[model samples]
Target: MAKTGEADADAFVEWFRAAAPYIHAFRGKTFVLAFGGDSLLRPDFVDLVYDINLLNALGVRLVLVHGVRPQVEERISEEAQYVRGRRVTDAATLEHVKDAVGSVRVDLESLLSVGLPNTPMAGAEIRVASGNYVTAQPAGVVDGVDLLFTGEVRKVAVAAIRDRLAAGEIVLLSPIGYSPTGEVFNLTLEEVATHAAMALEADKLVFILDHGDTVDAQGRRVSRLTASQAQRLLKELPEGDMKLYLPFAAQACKKGVGKAHLVSADVDGALLMELFTHAGVGTMVTRMSVENIRPAGIDDVGGILSVIEPLETEGVLVRRSRERLEQEIDNFFVDELDGRIVGCVALYSFAEVRAGEMACLAVDPTFRRGGRGDGLLAAVEEAAREQGLKHIFVLTTRTAHWFIERGFVLGGPDDLPAPRKAMYNWQRRSKVLVKDLEAA
Candidate 1:
């Protein structure tokens, strides 16, 4: 029998191998990490700092932004004078904000400076840099309430930040900005992080919130969301950390930041898990549709075949030769996710009869339950309508009920256009289902 220590070592080796791909993917990429001030009070914050150091050691350029609301509240005697989410920073409040922000900055800097021997950060020569990297303008007044020193991010010193990142130093940003006239203004950490990401065109923007996973209406944790979907969900959610961070995540995506992530600060090693795993432990938001459906190109022939070959062997789909697929590639549509085609359908128009035949609808078994098959069918139908086809039909030995549930009706082979009927495989004994475009 294998010793327990040996077995544990084997597991560690396997897990490290699995994380290698992510480490390679993130190398040389820039990431902006923002956290609430309350996170620093947690015991696991030191572990988080270690994770950040690990990321830097792996060659990921880092920008850190932190909020100080909780810290400021602790320092101030009258918490009622300021709002929780949106603080109206008067002279007294601004002083507390400065003190809180400064103290947090120092604490974070000191944490990152640790290099004690035999510890996780041993020999980690991590250098952190901070400066007047954010320019600000007063928020002025809203709802007739003068938000004295409360300001919004007007600009980010992208060049200076880039220079520091290039020098292998972590850029730290406080929830504070400086005006042209040298006045210090209190800023929102979310705004600062978002603007900095957009200005630098960073690869990712990550928000470490005080909560765990974001749940849907059914209370199921949502793993991913497109910008539009996140916006809609935000409207329905009450005022909370998810609601606060989602808009910034969506804005980062819209402004061309490659990806935005929301992870729970309460979970130890959440950042590392989210960054280094294939399926992250938190919600990820992107600009548009996560899986894009578009016309197939010549290069996608292999992926298309891979998706359909299993179904063809199982007799769920008719087999097509590589040559045939290459020739008819222009008529194919594929649902591509992270460069892999997980779903595909082909549309053949019988223009003489103002009708079309939908064929070869197949989605990877792993993705079938995710509605990709429905999306491909819809795409094919839309293409048919665009070509002025009056109706569309499908021939299937199986999946008849699936199509029927999606608006297709039972139809005889005789209803098919003459050209399509002539090409139908009599030996296959497939059922003909049709749907009218106008009726749909």
Candidate 2:
């Protein structure tokens, strides 16, 4: 029992230490968490609240936008009519919508206010703020049906929300919007969250759904996608909550939001796991390709140094001075992620032999598992081919097998071109591997 307790304590400390970077990264940043009323009905709602309190404690500016669709359905006896996913809100249904929205708003506010001793909320002082932050215009006469009070988000009060956030208050928004003409409009949870994140340029726009992470056609959980890829996947996905919310996530990414996430309310601590960990428990959508390979410029010398310096110290990569790197920057291709260069490879062509030497291939240790090395290598190969080179080769002391696995063949120094062979480091005795570009 003592050993088990010690092991558990060590694990907890390690986990907390691992999350420190993310904590520092997210502090003072804004996140918009959106969910349906179905989330409040779940047994895990208390757990979600606890996590939200933790985020608040960590200094994350939060905007909580909730939908009352399920709550409104429970209040109305008649069947609901929908045209193109917007509820056909008549006079009677509009009243029910208002009641449900008000009830949900109060319930959320009360839950966020909890501070009982010995509980997760103990000593946690959370102030909840809610107001007319969303402006809406009614979706009038869609498909010949008067969608009376069903509305679309016209604008979000960015200044008002920022004021609350600056005051250290958690801003709450209901799916109920008020117009300038003194009329109320019912909005969708997706639209409100999307617009608010866009308007605030929030760091993350997260949707807590009833299901787990988004899956592919083979039922495999997908971890990351670009906006274009998500749009392509949307056509194949069946009609469900994931399908319904995916477009909103993609739209937010394309508009201006840093990243959009679709996480499961069913999974405990899904929000924390998704935001703090490298391998999140949800699917993330970005604006475009997350890993971009582009020709290296003079400005990329420092980033390239950051990636290759550790390997140079370890003797896996040859040492190059900053001046040398700057001069050869034009021959390098870098893999950039979120504006940071994570990987790089350089192609030096030998016109005498119509061949290129791929060198200085290194990826940041943190990003080594994402196939970025392969991407960087592909960029070099393509560049070599474009320059009319017939073959490409690499000299690696530690990563011979990695290159061999990627179609490179082991060779002796005699196989190298005259210029490269003369410059080969005999002291390192690195293994030379060559690949035929035409065959590839």
Candidate 3:
């Protein structure tokens, strides 16, 4: 059942706190932030600045993309020119965009400097950089005008952004780019963030926009959403103005960015609130599937041991007799298909306060390519996550590549807990894979 009132708030807090350490693992990971001009214009600007600083402190690599739609239209109107909603990017207007984007970049930098003064953020040391990384698709003409140089993004060079990110620098993209053929193309803020996340394989794509967040049918905050849920919401609200961002958020996740957070810039410390509490601040859209991972009952032990015995015989897995497995049945989770178990994995969920071990994974041969392995692995991760475990370990003789493909990174035996390492036997020697799941 859906939670209510304090219960709902508590859920947000729990999810946040659970994610906190997992978020810590995100340090040094690249994140693409798309800030709408309306959001930047919010009265709660101080809250936004504080959140940015907090992310910096957490060791996250930041990419700030700010919108300038209203600012540009306002700039043109103030000069007594006809107020065309579109950006008039002729020679003179293009120069204005250069100036405008520059101004926004400088302003953001100055705001961040308030928290970290005397840090080399002025002049060339922290100057903005723009290049031909973005290719364009001409937007159709509006209001009888050709709409000139304003265009949408058709492609991007994500590697270039990753280079900047890996070098321990914050990249601030200004949604303004020069085409290969000497023409300039203006892009939407969300499009800029979406393309960058895809190109960079960022850990998350955050869209901080103006106005309050979405509400549920019951009027409570629609606090959490998976990728599919968000897509459903988008479909249900086709006529809703807020739906403009739905497509961008989905595209970001589809490109493998881990999450897309749609939150209110009005809420004070919303980032920390969403991240530090259990139920988060706004909707988090993710590509993660809805597979359930948990402890296996006694009945599952025989099947699991049967699967493990083959690998054990080949030395890919250590020997675990059916009797011994029955005693440890609580350590396993099975992947189910129409109520029949198709795959299973073991979780040692108590090596650290928020740590677990994934071991003895096996899938029915028929379900091999049906994503049962991935499902079992994800289920193990989810079980650990629900237990508030911050990290999980896997020791595999084969399938190291498979784990890596699923976001596992290489580690040494020493990365395991002391007891686990001490209990390790030469017969079980295998490459270790570790996944760090912290909150952001």
Q: In each prediction, how many residue pairs overlap at the backbone (N, C-alpha, C within less than 3 A)?
A: 0, 0, 22
TM-score of 1: 0.70
lDDT of each: 0.88, 0.88, 0.70
Candidate 2 C-alpha lDDT tens digits along 1-440: 99999999999998898789889989999999999889999987988998999999999999999989889999999999999877898889989999999899999998998898977769989999899999999989988998999998999999999999999999999998899999999899899999999999998999998854577766777677777778889888866678889999999988989899999887889899999876688888877553398899999999999999999999999999999999999999988988899898999999689889999999899987655776677678778989999989889999997887567899989989987889888999999999998876
Query: Please, what is the TM-score per model?
Result: 0.70, 0.73, 0.58
RMSD of each: 11.4, 8.9, 12.2
lDDT of each residue in 1-440, candidate 3, tens digit only: 45577798997796666667657777887777777766666777756766776676667888888887666665664452222544545556656666777777777777665634443322223323345667776665767666566777877777776677667666778777666676777777878888888877887788774644655444456654555666777765634324667678877887788777776666677766554544567766766444333458987776676666777777877788777788778888887666566678888876455679898898877667644576577667767888888998898888897886566889988888887888766665788888887632
| Candidate 1 clashing pairs, residues 3+ apart or interchain | none
- Quote the lDDT for 174 in model 3: 76
Better of 1 and 3 by TM-score: 1
**TM-score: model 2 vs. ground truth:** 0.73
* lDDT comparing candidate 2 with the true structure: 0.88
- Cα error, residue 298 of model 1, in Å, equals 20
Lowest lDDT block of 10, candidate 1: 77-86
Report the candidate with higher TM-score, 1 versus 2: 2
